[model samples]
Target: MLSPSSDSPADDVIRALADVADLVVVPHTRLADLTTLRIGGRPRALVECRAAEAVTAAVGALDAAGVPVLVLGGGSNLVVAGGDLDLVVVAVRNREIDYRTVEAGGAEAGGAEAGDGDTGPGGIVVRAGAGLTWDELVADTVARGYGGLECLSGIPGSVGATPVQNVGAYGVEVAQVLHRVRWFDRATGTDEWVSPGALGLAYRTSVLKNADRAVVLEVEFRLDAAGRSEPIRYAELAGRLGVTPGERTDPAVVRRTVLELRRGKGMVLDDDDEDTWSAGSFFTNPVVREGDLPTVRSRVADRLGVEQAEQMPAFPAAAGGVKLSAGWLIERAGFSKGHPSSSSPARLSTKHTLALTNRGSATADDVIALAREVRDGVRQAFGVELHPEPVWVGCSI
Candidate 1:
């Protein structure tokens, strides 16, 4: 409850959680060592659980005891603060899969969320444990000649965190294929599966993502057993696949193509590659009101040039809003790829302007400074506010 400012409190909290079965507890684990950005400080305690039940019990106990906690998966989408964070880290590590019942009938692919009905064979119902690596699952599904997750091929994180942020790539978002999510509700202290609708899943957000309200234990996804992909919705991917929008293709091909595209943009995780030392895109696409589009366009034309402004990317989004590319705005505002210099520990990714990377020795402050600069630059140039895509832990920009 006191947030473990001292070692005694950390030990006290760890001892309390350790009373539960099969929970491995460690003290003073550096947060940077656990995240993709590699830019956070140490936490008071860290508890890694091998089973879903253990995860649930550990989180529940910590919550009930009033101890602040962070439910960390692969730590891909997190941006934490510097110095010392004062919370417990509960690492979810349950990895199991049940791929029984491959049949020929009509069942939804990745379930109703994907917006496709049971078309060909009902498809295989593969439920993955929460802690399973998402890309690994995608690879397995593609290897088995199944189709569904190909569009999300190279996202780096745990499957459990997928639904949390409605993790999306190419043209596919997890909400489309997410059948259901099983989680341990810290409030009620009950572990159960709930429909996706209950999650309030929207673009890059869900009730559970940064809330720490629940810890996801497992996830169920419906895949095409006929070995075909879901309809291709992204223009780039569809073009590469030689198919029109809303067309289906071999799942393996889709995965390969998506991975290729992601690598080009530095969206895929590669340890040896400094370009991939990021938490993916740093900012969400700015959504503007339909009625204000003309004004926004005029502003862009005024700042840059009529031709350049006319060439800006704008797509129709939900609720009469138009989504504009954040990366374009950043580059146009004078922050090119690898901006600020080639020597800074924190800088724009050399491969993509949308990502802010930790060049092997950046701190949280360094990352935050770069983010603020980019966000402010975009706002000053275009009067559009860019929101960060990753969830912040113990830090704000």
Candidate 2:
């Protein structure tokens, strides 16, 4: 529990937010309990808002008071420090879902056209509250025979965070289907809906990530009405579904196959599996300049032989560079799955090299140490710098 002075600024802000409708002030809540990593310490206080207006009210008050604030969603992509922190957590808890049908060739929902071949007749738009669980929304869409979101199945976190990180899996990214985002702009104190172009969406990041620019209140995604999944661009997924790449299949089958692949890599969250207790993927695939690719391949060949280096996974990134697999790099750098032995509190996940997991007793420091070791090892071995995917608070590697 926080025991600040009577006149502390946090206390004053709490008093000011007491009357905000649908906002609850929770004291002594640990970040560990709120995050999927199951590690972290307590914030000064937690402000849980149940509605969009309430979220705006609470966050606006904190911003006005100059109180340090952390806008928490599902806590799936956070790496927070331990000990009693000085920041206040504003939790978005609005859980509304609305589906609107758009007539083909009509005005698009959020100023964006539907996917290719989706203009035949009907298109579905799903507006989900920022606080709703991500997978829950995906399951709902698949259950109704809708497509578009099946490739992103089994991802943790909230709907609001999808655009923030441009969440993607199985070759599908949120930027491909995002209709519009309703956000509360911090700088202007105005609530408005903006199209995807307003967001600087990249491989795995956006303007909203790591910046306190705005708080997402709700998100809308376009869906296919023909009950067919998005074109399978991932080779592994397509091979498993017995279809060639770029072919569309059943949404249910895609969802099931994606889930299976995720579970095998311990990407899905499960209480019984310690390996699933992580911040999903710890590192983004490193994109190297086209000219530098040869140097990296030469280094790999010198150390790991020509055959292994030739088989290294390299994909053409949208930004004109070759994206190298971080997991493959980590393994080839001598950091195997469950590296540094079974006795360490924090180590590489037993199921996946890219995930840094907590063995029930790991601290933020433990995770940071292991992350540095792997990142530095890869850098030394291949000259490619690996960047962390999760947002960091009060700590860094």
Candidate 3:
């Protein structure tokens, strides 16, 4: 007979899940090894799923037993608490990619012929496994001479997480080209493919965020096959590429420039660089209502001179609000790049004002303390709240 110790709740679930091919389960895994922050504690269990069926089977069994599941991807956009976590981590590892150009009359999901493909009036399509690194897909597409993802080239995370946050940068968002998303609906235990419209995508957010309503299995993006990039919208990118505002430049040029800019900002992941040991762009730029822009501008004018206020960076939000720079608010609020000091365990990235980084020995608490300090400080100075972009686990800001 088996020992009673051999059949605990997690073990029972794992045993039942073993029948699913390509799904592996291990107990007592540290989340610090799984997140970009490098500060989380160990989870009760870790499930590695290499295929969609394995993911569904493993998660379904865990959910049925009322086990808390934390779906982990590339771990680029997460912060988890340091200590014994009470949940199980589901790490997606499938990595498959297929390319298709839209054929005449808009073929069905599997209608297009498979090849290196091109973009044009009909558009190119890329289908990738949920576990694929986002930048890898972008690099592949651009290398093949595609252009739609140029502005978003250096972003870190999984393909599946893109639509969850409607990931955007340099004025380009995943929502603009997402065609289909295959998800395992947690609430219903159903797996299926749905159109992008079903996710209710918006600026840096979607239905999958915080709700834990579903687990994305794969993603499909439509791309420009004409070998020209989307219109250059971000001024900094345009200037670096030597293109006029709104001009369509080569995707390769845009990708290179964006990577350079991100590296300088410590937004790109660099294992050897402590400044990049962070969740890129810690705060999303705050968007104030249309009527509220003047109040903010006036505040800036009052604090710094009228000339400074006139030059403050502000843009019309896609949803009509006025988007103010979070970095600007942080700096004006007295938090400079590498705020606190180089000796502190948690400090602002010296390369960028927006990133809150871990200086090798930071506990989750250390990072949180800095985040709260920056956030509360910014609110007091500018009356604008800074919202964190990374997903927080077992902690709140």
The prediction achieving the highest TM-score against the true structure is 2
Put the candidates in lDDT order, highest first.
2, 1, 3
Candidate 2, residues 95-200, lDDT tens digits: the string is 9998877776644555543433233347888889999999999999999999999999999999989999999999999998888889999999999888888889
lDDT for each residue of candidate 1 in 1-397, tens digit (9 for 90 to 100): 2344565544666887777776889876888889999977878888999899899888877776777888888999999887767788999888998774433554443333332223335557678989899999999989999888889999999999999889988888988887778888888888887878889998888998668688899998878877889899999889988999999999988888888999998989998898998899999999999888788788889998899889999999988899999999999988999999999999999999999999999988899999999999988888889999999987889
Q: 2 or 3: which has the higher TM-score?
A: 2
Error of 1 at 241 (Å): 2.1
How many clashes in each structure? 4, 0, 3
Q: With candidate 1 superimposed using the best TM-score fit, by how many Å does residue 347's alpha carbon deviate from the native?
A: 0.4
Position 171, candidate 3: lDDT: 79
| Model 2, residue 365: C-alpha shift (Å) | 0.4
Query: What's the candidate order when arranged by decreasing TM-score?
Result: 2, 3, 1
- Model 2 has an lDDT value of 0.91
**Reference-based lDDT, residue 119, model 3:** 29
Winner on lDDT (2 vs 3): 2
Any runs in candidate 3 off by more than 4 Å, and if so which?
1-8, 108-121
lDDT of 2 at 358: 92
TM-score computed on alpha carbons, candidate 1:
0.93
Per-candidate TM-score against the hidden true structure: 0.93, 0.96, 0.94
RMSD of 3: 3.6
Candidate 2 residues lying further than 4 Å off, grouped into runs, are 1-6, 108-121
